[model samples]
Target: MKVKHITIIGLGLIGGSLGLALKKQCGEALKVTGVDHDQETLELAVQRGAVDYSTNDWKRGVEQADIIFLCTPVLQIIPIVEQILPYVKVGGILTDVGSTKGFLAEKLLYMMPSGVHYVSGHPMTGIERSGIMAADRGLFKDKWYILIPEASTSPEAVEIISQTLTWTGARITTMDLYDHDQCAAIISHIPHVVAAALVNLLGKYPALEESFKLVGGGFRDTTRIASSNADMWADICLTNSQPITQSLLQLKELLDEMIQAVEKADRPAIHHFFKRAKVRRDILIEETDSHVV
Candidate 1:
């Protein structure tokens, strides 16, 4: 089962880059079409050779494609899914590149038209920037793509989609949607809140902000993705607010305990906490570096 007619909705950074990747991988076997809300971006995608055809109309393009990729923002995904559900071709493979998954995917499932095969996916890679010009063809290469396919999804559909992703140089992994969302709360969403807080801290103290001039690679790296689309990030936090709040509280508790330990001159308590954390952090860094290399 080869994918021929493909329509990618949203010609933003991810969508445009995906169109190019699919063309490079599938060659003539795949015919890529892109639908974008912005006419300028849609035309840019076509000019860049990312898509064979581009349009702003969802009804005309989405309904007939054999494979459709939803690359829009997280919050708008559900409504967009519902609006285009009727147009999705029978047996069409549906997928999305969204950060938060569980709640959104489930909503789409109940609302999606019958006979359409949908598999949820998130490529755990991207920079702080976005838009058509910021598109990178190798963005997903050597990165992890978490695919959450529902029980109703066919094994054949999963296989074909997995193969397509492998062509983009991404490693495929599967997880339950709930677990994925919870995991993202700690690793993804919590960090954005922290960075946004850190930047706000710098903003509050302009005089002391000269200290930012002394900031090194670690600070820059830590806050790099903090510069992403604010509206999109707001949606991510709001969509998974409960888990993010829980993580934030847990972090607050840890810091409070550390402060108490420092006030009491509890050196051993501080040492124990830092030691455990460093060990785990090192393991994660090593694992990520190993995979990337």
Candidate 2:
């Protein structure tokens, strides 16, 4: 089914980018409406051509939408979903760009009214900078977009949602909700936590603070995402606490092994650990390179 209009809530980086990408691909065929509490963001989205319509009133934005992308924070996504359930058109599709999927699936499965379809999605793409000003039309290009649909979800709903995402140049991958959260925990959530932890470690030692001034590319690159919005990260960490904690514990176990090996002067074990990591890193680089073209 053709999507005539899409209403994007939040009007932040993800929401604004979706609107821009849709307008670029569908041209006049699709109408994009941007909804946000911030009047400045709504106006910026319109001025930047990311959206055709801007409104602080979500009811007006979503009333006629064929699809609604609830691009709010993870904690806010559920509440917004509840609020908009009554307003969504019958047969209309609703999706999200949240990082965590398990919480959403659990909360929305029974709350979703009949006639409206819900498909949880996470676009594996973003930058440290956020908000409408940082929105980029190419944000999702060639990036992975994971969709988690329940067993009750209609095939037609998944197809329509998949078709809509294709317009943004994303590579769509559908997976079970639990598996999605586990993978995200390892690849995204734990990494952010580690980044922040690394930064915090520096704060703990004021004696080395002066020496830290000489930190180079490695330090900057590793902690680049540590500067992300605190509120957003806090909500994500809370929502996906279980998986994130598991991943962190696994990391701790590995670190303990490495520390013991180094303390024992076990050259062979240290070499083997480094070799294993190098092999995996090389394979990852090779795989990423193969996908570039």
Candidate 3:
């Protein structure tokens, strides 16, 4: 599976990282062309050898590539895919790195051009850091990439994308787009929301300063996601609110249970919760070597 010319839109952390990875891992057979709204990012991408060329013009980038990775946020992919449909060549593979997939998958199918290939992809890996400076060439190494293929999607297209992604040290996993969104909502989206809320709550309680001083590794890890880009997180909540809401409700139930147990002095129940949580965390660590579970 060879990609001669690839276009990466946005060229932020995800896009820029992809370009860097592809160029390093598959550079001999690929020419990455980055399209970013920012001039500095474009220049950095070129300097870092992430792309052979960089442009802000969508038409120029789309017309010359065999594959396109829409690295834009979840909410933005729909309109960009719509506008790009007309410009993209007949056989080009169009995929995205959006977190939510249900709405994106449906919208792409609805507006996709006759000859264009659309595959919904979610790279289940990222950092709290932002921009090209924070972009690492090894970001996707040993990570999980979910490929959501539609009924109309070409097998050859799927194979090509899967193989190309694998070249970047990522393993490909396939699942229903809706199922993907549901899982992401629970494990990813809900956690981000809770983290941000935790940080906000800390801000509101000045009296908690003494207690908060003991905030250590666990607290840092739990609240790390709160530092992610607000605009991007907001978009994920908007596009995938259904699953996110469900996740939130489930989480609230669990939290309420814990609160009630503590209030009623149910020591046994509280101990049971911690015991189960520890087991779950241990199992999660065992699966850490996987790209995306």
Candidate 4:
């Protein structure tokens, strides 16, 4: 399917950045429209050249769109899609940048209108900051963007979406719904939880102010993601509960091992634990850095 007109719902960081990148790369070939509830955000998106036009009306925004991107929070995506499905042009494609995919794929696969297609996507890139003001056209550059297409989805639709996303400078790959959610739980969801937990733990201290005074790069770097949007993180945790819980339990086990070693003053065990972590983390960083463009 040849994409010409595109509609992006939710003019926040991901949506705004995507609009900017698409506009910059596709130029006059693609007519990008941005939709947000906030009129100020719509105006800002237009001013930033993120889209050709902007609107607060979902129906009007999607009327002429060939591809509609749902960039809202996980829970809001389905409702927004449901509202706009009737307005979506026949043969149009719909996709998302949500964090979780299993539930989305299960529901959206059957929810799409007969001629319209739904493809689940998650871009594995973002910072703690959000909103249109923080959006950068290069946010997705050199990052992994996973596409989850159901068996019912057409190859033409997937190819069209992939080609469009490629213009953002992302490395595109495909994954099944189950695998995508499971891996995301490990890499993204649980890490956010851990970061929040670390910050909360610090907050619980009796001498919190004093302790904060001694904060260094280690604490800042580790807990940077804790500053991410709480509503979005809450939705992610609720939607992907099982995977997140399982990962958290496994993490608890590791923490228990360390706690026991400390309690018993097991020097060798402590040394072994740190050494093993250092080795694995070093290897992981080395492998990841090798892939950077």
Candidate 5:
């Protein structure tokens, strides 16, 4: 079925971008409604042409929506789902742009009404920034938008979500909920923690603060993600604690091995470590280039 009315909650970067993308792709065929608790954000989203209509009243925004996109923080998605479940139309599909999906998939599948559907999703795109002003119509273009559907998720819901997101030029990936979380913990969640920890390490050396001014592109590039929304990351880390923690433990083991190699002046072992990492990194670059072509 064609989606006519789409309600997007949270009106932040992802939500606003989805609004702009829908407008750009579907034009007058689809009506985009944006809901946010912040009035300034609603105004900014309207000014950016990212939304056709703006509302603070979520119930009103979702009442007649054919599809609902919860673009809130990882933890907020399910709560919003619960709040809108009563107003969501029968057979309507509800999805999220949350980073972690295992718990969300479980809870949403249980809470979704008999006729309604919920599919947990995560878009592997964004900047080191936030807010409506940072919204980009092309943010999701050529990016991976993952859909983690539980056993209860309907095929119709998956198709609807895939079709809607396809307009944004995203390459859709379908995976089971558990596998999705495990992958995210390694590639996304743990990287954020590593970035933050690196930046925080600088805080411990007040005497070397002056030396930091000399740090250039490498430091900035490595820590760019550390500037992302803290509260949002906090929620993701907590919700997906199990996998993130496991990944960190594995990372710590690697770091310990590197430290031992350095202390023992094991040049051969250190060289092998760096060489192995470089080989893996080059392989990733080659694979990415192949995919782009």
Candidate 6:
């Protein structure tokens, strides 16, 4: 549990930023290794000082690791863990930055090697940008990092991973796997889906070219997340389908209510809807801003 050697698989934004933060905060106390399938990414990670070493060999990367971070896309996490299981050091802690956790927790709990511990984690941070080039050392600062540990996960392992993640300046919190997924579906998953849908709606307009000419801060801000990595979002949607589907249905109901009110020219209903949203959004922003460090 004394984490000295850390191996991060998938040197994308989250993984690379984690490496940079760890190296910055922990200095030489931790030996960080960056792993990616792409040799160019590994070189970039090394050049950026994100890790002490970089490699494409999974076995070599994880063999000496005291803690392994799986920062890959949701779909790839399990497969990568399966491949690295044999090489992972005994008593090492395995964690992840995957957005959805229900499926991951279930599978990882069953697949974890006898000696190794699997602790599921999801950092509620990151920009719309992807890749190591977009990695920022301060990305996780003041952001929420949710940990969902399985019953089989040892308390010592949870404490070790939590302590290590603190070096990145993230606010650590724990949640039940099911609760985490459900909450994520509402706050993270649904927002991404809606953002993409808004962009796609604009794309389908007949006067798209003319409409784009009038594009302002509102549209850009609302749809910024639509520019995020498509493959990763797709994987999230697939893995957290149940919660996401239910949330989407609720969203649809709200939208239908708005559509009916507008169709019927019900001015009072429209005004009330916008008023309620404004009040709720204002309170949400106020409360959130109050918590920022």
- Which pairs of residues collide in model 2? none
Q: What are the TM-scores, per candidate, against the unseen true structure?
A: 0.94, 0.97, 0.95, 0.97, 0.98, 0.97
Question: Mind giving the per-residue lDDT tens digits that candidate 4 earns over 248-273?
Answer: 99999999999999999999999999
lDDT of 1 by residue, 127-199 (tens): 7898888887888788899999877767887888898888788889998888999999998888888888877
Q: Which candidate number has the best TM-score? A: 5
Residue range 1-293, candidate 3, lDDT tens digits: 35788999988889888988988987667888898888998999899888889988889988978899999877888778767777898789899999988878887867777777888899988999888888888899878888998787788889989988987788788988778999999889999999999989998989888898889999899999999999899999999988999889999999999999999999999999999999999889877745243
Candidate 1 residues lying further than 4 Å off, grouped into runs, are none
| lDDT score, candidate 6, position 163 | 97
For all candidates, the clash counts are: 1, 0, 2, 0, 0, 0
Report how far residue 62 has shifted in candidate 6, in Å.
0.3
lDDT of candidate model 3 versus the reference: 0.87
lDDT, each prediction: 0.85, 0.89, 0.87, 0.92, 0.89, 0.93
What would the TM-score be for candidate 6 when compared with the true structure?
Answer: 0.97
Clash pairs, candidate 1, are 63-87
Write the residue-wise lDDT of candidate 5 on 1-293 in tens digits: 88999999998889999899889999999998999999999888888888888989868889989989999988888777777788888988889998888777787888887899888889999888998988899998988899887777898889899999999989898988888899999989999999999999999999999999998999999999999999899999999999999999999999999999999999998999999999999999899768751
- lDDT-superior candidate, 2 or 6: 6
Question: Model 6 misses residue 224 by how many Å?
Answer: 0.4
Q: How does residue 119 of candidate 6 score in lDDT?
A: 90
Question: Candidate 6's residue-wise lDDT over 15-103, tens digit each?
Answer: 99999999999999999998899989999999999999999998899999999999999999988998999999889888989999988
Q: Distance (Å) between predicted and true CA of 263, model 4?
A: 0.8
Model 2, residue 54: distance off in Å is 1.0
lDDT of 5 at 244: 97
How well does candidate 3 score on lDDT at residue 83? Answer: 72
- Deviating ranges (above 4 Å) for candidate 4: none
lDDT score, residue 117, model 1? 79
